[model samples]
Target: MDKRYVRAAVIALMLAGLTLHGGIASAQQKRDTIRIGFVTFLSGPAAGPFGVPARMAAEAVVEQLNAGKAPAPYDTKGFGGTPIELVVIDEAGGTTKQVSEFRNLVSRQNVDYVIGYISSGDCLAIAPVAEEMKKVTVLFDCGTPRVFEEASYKYVFRTRPHATMDAVAAALYLLEQKSGVKSYGGINQNYAWGQDSWHDFDLAMKTLKPDARVTTSQMPKFGSGQYGAEISALIQSGSEVIHSSLWGGDLEAFMMQSVPRGLFRKSQLVLVAGEPYLHRLGANMPDGTIVGARGTHGVFAPDSNLNTWLKTIYKAKAGHDPNYPAYVATLAFLGLKTAFEKAKLEQASSLKPSDDALIATFEGLSFDSPSGRATMSLGKGHQAVMGTAYGTTKLVNGKVTVTNVKHYPAERVTPPNGISSPDWIKGGMKPGK
Candidate 1:
């Protein structure tokens, strides 16, 4: 009787072990595709110049990733061997609409991650929503410092530098090039992005060039192409250097109007964000115009394998050279790829990344980008910083090119930990200090 009972028990135990092993194997085999939501200005004032090229680059990169043809570190198949699916969303709608769209991407679309935003107001409005929704999000282009300064969020990050870096770099370029120019004039768009950029540039001017004075300032409405009145005032005020942070269609419109009106002939123009429009404006864009590309992006980027690969592919697909937006979009997507791979390694799982895992992996992470190495700060805040590039625009053989290009290290352009950008400038922080 004892022998028979032992045999029966052994058989039951063997069957239980087999069932458990099969369950675990099945769970491991069932891998879901990684879904991502990409939002950008696909159909608005920013569409033609900024968002369209960004979307084109996004599509090409996703395709390359899916094909397992991307560069090293991101060279593996789509998001750590799991195929990636992308959903594109337009960011033309105002702030309220963007908030709704971001929620929809998380709740309805069930996106594992979301990226892209060009409008600073949209970035500010959506950051809190992303936090409340507990969705992993990235802002590719918005530059307002308020995203992290005004409030903090665990689930959101910006893979590009803020507006302050752009302004600071612009001011440094101006002073380095034309130190004798003592008068500065501002003509930023009337919006969060424009206002913040103007403030930062003004502060930088005062900090670096204490003797310089702002002769006149204009807060033109965003998308308001009519700048005749503002141009008139700028000319009348006798400004030696006119600092502007306008971008996309607005930047293009200003360049077009000002060129015809001889505004460029009167004063030295410093455009904080002027790369994207260079392709469209070509020779019309005045030579020697000081321009900043937010970071070491686009035309100002140094030669590297990653930059060359992205530019080649993007140009082939879009039929034009990639711009600043494309570079930032690629950076954000590559950062996500890096984060997903890291999560997979930490969890020892081959499945798609979860929202929490993605966020944890991204915080304080560093990776290579077209612009150089980008670092997400964990000690200060979850903000990504990279080197900045600034230069003057020149027409070379019927093509727009940047001259006197300089790259400012992230430490120089980015503020120190626990200090807001404005305070950092007013406190007399200088590059390389």
Candidate 2:
């Protein structure tokens, strides 16, 4: 045999073996990996307070899941032995831009699961897109009740309670703590989340306390970063009680600007989603400011071994306590893990579970979170119902902390079956009574 011909034959064999090996590796990767697109406000005003911690929680949870070191029900080691690979996307632009980005994530990125959305407008925009594209998605933090109210979906579901719960919890807390507060005022971001929060809070007040009137309503643009005029309007309204659902940097700015203007001292303020700003505001946070996590979260509430573990891990990773955004994100990941495992168990095939399998598993599911139990409504458009916790803020040892905390079950605030929130209120069922 010629030396050149022999050498060429040897090289061809080597190349063939390498190609076979590569094909096997690719197949193994596909079977063992779960790709997730995790979207949150990585930039813009909501980044520092809300998105960053949530992202950190995502990183920590994924690391733990990959290592098979998480707590139970979540101890299954990464979605039933498959590793999680998360691609983080910044939710900065407007609703239209978000819709486009969502499409890109589903079609181009080819992610298995899509999670995270703090903006209500973004949530409303992306739900339909997820359904149209047949993408399985979990809206982790968006609280607008309008998502399910406006449309129905098979592949889209929110893993956290809706915005109406926060408002109802706040109103119930106010009436319980401050029965003398006959007049109230509201200042919320002028968007879907804010508008829905204000409306729900107002309706809750009317149903729970009929004598109480909303004297003034201020709808500041999202991320406006200024609330001096809105503060003045609130003050002039002579409201004995004030309500706000602002979160992230907007909430911080409002509190800072309002404190100097004596807004906090003048009226009792209730913040529907305020836990994110607690550490940032610290002593600057007004004493007696009634606030709630969108659900049971933050350092003061969610007193459990799971929450303790979460706080310890989150503080070690991000050098701070875990807040509502972080808690909700963690819960969302756990829910995903549960769904994937359940889907795997229910299916007959040994092959990897499909997106439809995951969706079916997620619908009408119940799982344990760090805070507590969370359930997805079986026939109610896949809406989630989680308990919420409220408390009063105080400067304790120069740190902002909540005390006198209370928990409201999901059924307390959630609208009845087949009834809108406004109609439920108009129907004269006083929540939390």
Candidate 3:
């Protein structure tokens, strides 16, 4: 009588063991998709030039990686089986909104990494949160030196060169190309990027041509539609050269306003972040205007292998030529790919890599970018060592293009260690006592 009941109980136990084993097997078989949080101004005046292309580039890169169609040096799948799953967040308007979004991404969404921030202020605001959360943040296009300088967060790493490098490159180009240019004026947006750009350009120009005076300085509130007041002030000051750091809608509006006012006729206009707007502005942009990307122009002119491939892929996906935003997006992913590959190697060797391992992998890691080779220095601050490209604007065949291109080495412009940009400028500007 007991044997029959015992056999039934043994069968039940066997079924339960199989069920538990199957559950564990299913969990092990599930593929882990790397989650990345991407933040940008997707709906605003700045969206068209900076945010739109950035989103497009991100999608394109992910798509290519999944499809197994991307090339080497930037090939995402080359880092083994870690496929990325991006969760995009639209940081509606300001730095405050960006900080809020960053907290949500880290605390709530629990993303593996973060990649996008076009505004300098937003990047600066979010750097602390990244450090607190212990997330790897690959900043795409925030160029203000203050982001890396004022806040020395170990988790923050920028792919683009700082504003000071952009300013130095532009200043050197203007003096080398333009003849009989003595006095210059600056018209920049009233923000950290603008302030730093003008200050650095002034310093560089003073060093290159000491007697070259900066006659007029104007910093209009960003996104201001009309630049007539600033343009008039510069004209009245009788300066022969003008430098501007306006970007996105701000730059577009400035170009539309200043071109017809005969400002270009009076002075040689130098507009940073100009290549991105070339297609949008086309013939409306003043010819012979000196303009380029902040640190490096992101286009295939004649000698860039990566730029050529990027241009083709970007145009095929978005139906437009790739700009600096595309370059930033690509660089962001490249940095991630590099770190993950290194992490994988460490994991294979029976080592448990920490978040700092990811950061250390990027330190001194160099890769060929669309513009040129970019490397990170994990010194006092995790800043990038990247080159820049500059050129003059011209409408050729109904398309805007930057001609007579010149590339500048990054080390030539980066300031020395322990020296803040503001302090360096102040020291350089001081008169002999």
**TM-score per candidate, chains pooled:** 0.89, 0.88, 0.86
Candidate achieving higher TM-score, 2 or 3? 2
Residue range 243-305, candidate 3, lDDT tens digits = 887887778778787778788787898886677887888877888988877666564233576
Off by over 4 Å in 3: 1-31, 76-79, 300-305, 349-353, 378-381, 423-433
lDDT of 2 at 183: 96
Instruction: List CA RMSD, all candidates.
Output: 11.6, 7.3, 9.5
Report the C-alpha displacement of residue 257, candidate 1, in angstroms: 2.1
Clashes of each: 0, 1, 0
TM-score of 2: 0.88
Pairs in clash, predicted candidate 2? 143-163
Per residue, candidate 2 scores C-alpha lDDT tens digits across 1-433 of 6899999999999999988775654455444578899999988877887888899999998998889888776877777877888989999998988888888676666677899798887988888888889988899988777788767888888888777778888888888898888899999999877888888888888878888887999999988998888999998998998888887778878888988888877799988877778878887788999988888877544567677778878989998788888988998998888888888987746544787887887888998878788888723638788778789988989988788888887788777556677787667654432
The TM-score that candidate 1 achieves is 0.89
Off by over 4 Å in 2: 1-31, 348-351, 378-381, 430-433
The positional error of residue 99 in candidate 2, measured at the CA in angstroms, is 2.8
lDDT at 146, model 3: 80
Clashing pairs for model 1 are none
Q: Lowest-lDDT window of 10 residues in candidate 1?
A: 22-31
- Backbone clash pairs for candidate 3 read none
